[model samples]
Target: MSPIRTIVLTLLALLAFAANSVLCRLALNAEQVNPADFTSIRLLSAAFILAIIIVIKDKSAIRHINQHGSYAGALFLFVYAAGFSYAYISLSTATGALILFAAVQFTMLFKGWLAGNKMGNQEYIGLLLSLLGFIYFVFPELEKPSIVGCLLMILAGIAWGMYSLNGAKSTKPLYDTASNFIRLTPIAIIGLIATYFYFGLHISYKGLLYTTASGALASGVGYTLWYQVLPKLKPSIAAVSQLSVPIWAALGGVLLVEEPIELHLAISAAIILGGILLVILAKNKH
Candidate 1:
C-alpha cells in the first residue's frame, strides 16, 4: 500500500473506534434498547458479518478455531460488550471512552506485572498517574456523572483488557476473533434470555438499526481495518494513534450528539491518556 493509503486507513480505523462509543451512547442514551438485548444483537451481528468475511477472505482463520480461542476470551468479549452497552446508559460518550481506555491499560499493565514483567521507572510513574487520574475522574461527586455508569465502564474496560491479552496470544488475529465470537453466541443467548425474563426486551426498529450498525460497521469492520493497519504501523505509532479515539469520541459527542462536557472530564482525560501514552512509549523505548 502507498504511504497515503496507509495513513488514511489508520485514520479511518481510529474514527471507527470513536464511532463505537458515539453509536452506543446515541442508542442507550435514548433508551431505545435494553443493554442485554443490544449486546446480544451486537454480538450476533458482528459474528455473522465477520464469519462471512473470514469465510470468503481467509477460511484458514476459522479452520482451527479451538487452537486460537478460549472460553475465557469469549466470556471477556461478552462482558465487554454487555458492560459497554449498559455503561452508556448514563455516561457521556467521551467520559465512558476515557474511563474504558484507562481501565484497559491498567488491566494490561497489572496483568503484565503478574506475568513477571517489571516496569521501569517511567512505567511505574505513568501507572500511578493513570490511577490517580482515573480516581479523580470518577470521585468527589462533582466530577462524577454517574457512579453506576463509571463502574460499568470500568468493568467493560477490564473485560476488554482480558480479551486483548488473550487475542495477543493467538497467531492469527482474525481467526481468533471469529472463534471467540462464535463461542460468545451461547453465552449471549443465556444473558438475553435472563434479561428477557427480568426486564423484558426494549427495542424499537431504530434502536435495532443502531445496534446493528454498531456491530457490523463499528466493531466488525473496524476491527478488520485495525488489523490491517497494525502491520503497517510502528508499535509506538499505533499506541499513540489510539489516543485520538477518546478525543474524537468527545468531539463527536459535543457536535453530533450534543452532549455537555465538563472541564474536569477534559483534564482527567488528558491525564489518563497522557499517562498511558507514556507507559506504552516507555515500554517500547527498549
Candidate 2:
C-alpha cells in the first residue's frame, strides 16, 4: 500500500475510535436510549458487521466462529461496553476518554509488574505522574467531574485492558475479535431483556442510527483497519499514535456536540498524556 493510503486509513481508524465516545455521549445526552439498550444494540451491530467481514474474507470462516474466542473474553468485552455506555451518562467526551485511557495504561502496567516485569525509575516516575494528574483531574476544585462516572469509566478501561491482554497472543486479531463479538450475543440479549423489564425500553431512530454507526463503523470496521495497519507501523509508533484518540474525542465533543473545554481539562490532559508518553518511550527503550 502507498504511504498516503496507509496514513489515510490510520487517520480514519483513529477518528472512528474517537467517534465511539462522541456518539455515545450524543445518544445518552439526548436521552434517546438507556445505557443498557445502547450497549446491547452496539454489541449486536458490531457482531453482525464483523461476522460479515469474516465471511467475506473466507467463506468457511462461519464454521470456525466457535473455534476462536473464549467466554471470558466475551465477558470482559461486555463489561467494557456496558460500563462505557453507563459512564458516558455523566462524563463528557473528553473527560471520559482521558480517564479511560489513563486507567487502561495503569491497569496494563500494573498487570505487567505483577507478572514479574520490572519497571525502571522512569517507568515508576511516569506512573506517579499519571496518578497525580488523574487525582488533579477529579479533585473537585476545577469543573468537578462526576465521581460515579469516573469510577465507571475506570472499570471499563480495566476491563478493556484485560480484554486486550487476553488477546495479546492471538495469531489472528480480527478473527478473534469478531468471534468475541459473536459470543456476546447471549449476554447482550439477557442484558437487554433485564433492562426492558426493569427500566423499560426507550429508543429513538436517531439513537439507533448513532449506536449502529458506533458499533459497525467505529468499532467493527475501525478495529479491522487498525489491525491491517498494525504490521506497517513500529510498536512504539503504534503506542504513540493512540495518544491522539482523546484529543480527537475532545475536538469532536467541542465542535460536534457543543461541549465546553475547561482550562483544567487542558492542563490535566497534558499531564496525564505526557506521563503516558514517558512510559511508552521508556518501555520501548528498555
Candidate 3:
C-alpha cells in the first residue's frame, strides 16, 4: 500500500474501533446483554472469525504464537478484553474511552523510558498537561461511578498499553498480531464463561448478534489492521491518534444513545484534545 493509503486505512481502523465502543455500550444499556456475556461472546466470535481467515490465507501464521514474543502479547489482549467489557456496565462510553486511552498513554511513556528512548523536554511537559486533563475529567465521575466498573476499565487500559508496547518490540509483527488472537482466545473464553457463572446471566439472540458483530468487525478485523499499522507508526503518533476516540465515542453516544453532554464533558474534551495535540506537535519538533 502507498503511504497515503496506509494512513487512511489506519484512520479508518481507529474509527471502527471507536464504533466498537459505542456498540458495546448500546448492547449493554439497551439490548440488555450482561457485560460479561457480551465480552465472552465478542472475544470468542472474534477468535473464530480470525481463525477462519488465518486458515484460509496462511496456515503458517499459527506458528507465530509459539514464538517468545507472543506470550506477552497474548496476556495483554486477554486482560484488556476482559476488563474493557466489564467496565461498560456502569461507565459511559465516552468516559470509558477517555480513561482507557489516557491510561494507555502513560503505559506507553513508561515503555519508552524502559526502552531507553530519550524523552525530550517538550514530551514531558505535554505528558503533564495530558495527565492533568485526565484527572480533571475523571474526578467528578468517581463520586457515583461503579467501583467495579472503574477498576475494570483501569485494568483494561493497562493491558492495552502492554499490548501496544509489546507489539512495537516484536520482530514478527504479522504473525504476532494474528497468533496473539488465536492464543488469547481460549483464555478469554474461559474468563467470559466464569463471568457468566458469577453474574448469572444469559445471552439473547439480539445480544449475541450485536456482540458478535463487534468482535468480528470492530475487534477482529480492526485489531488486525491496528497491529499491521503499529510497527509503522511512531509511538507518539499512535498515542495521539487515540485521543480522537473519546470525541468520536462521545458524539456516538449523543447521536445513538441520547446520552447527555454536560458542560464538564465538553470542557474536559477540549483540555484532553489540546494536550494531545501539544504532544504531537512537540514530538514533531524532534
The best candidate in terms of TM-score = 2
Please write out the lDDT profile of model 1 over residues 1-286, one tens digit for every residue. 7889889988987898799998887777664688778888888888888889888986775666667667897888888988899899888899888888778778877887898977899988888888888888778644555888889989999997777656555566566667677788777778778988999886887788888888888887776666666666765576677778889999999987898889999889888888988898897886
lDDT of 2: 0.84
Candidate 2 or 1, higher lDDT: 2
Cα lDDT, all candidates: 0.80, 0.84, 0.77
Q: Which TM-score value belongs to model 1?
A: 0.86
Per-residue C-alpha lDDT of model 3 across residues 86-167, encoded as one tens digit per residue: 7988888887887777777777767767988777777777777877886787787667756567678888988988887777
lDDT of 3 at 26: 84
Q: Which structure is stronger by lDDT: 2 or 3?
A: 2
Better of 1 and 2 by TM-score: 2
Instruction: Encode model 2's per-residue lDDT on 1-286: one tens digit a residue.
Output: 6889988988987898799999999888865678888998899899999998888889898888889877888888888998899999989999998888777777777887899989889988887888888888888833544788899999999997787567555667678778888998887889889999999887888988998888888877886667667667664566577778899999999988899999999999999989888888898898
Ranking by TM-score: 2, 3, 1
Candidate 3 structure lDDT = 0.77
Candidate 1 colliding pairs, count:
0
Model 3 misplaced regions, further than 4 Å: 59-69, 118-121, 169-174, 192-201
Residue 17 of model 2 has an lDDT of 73
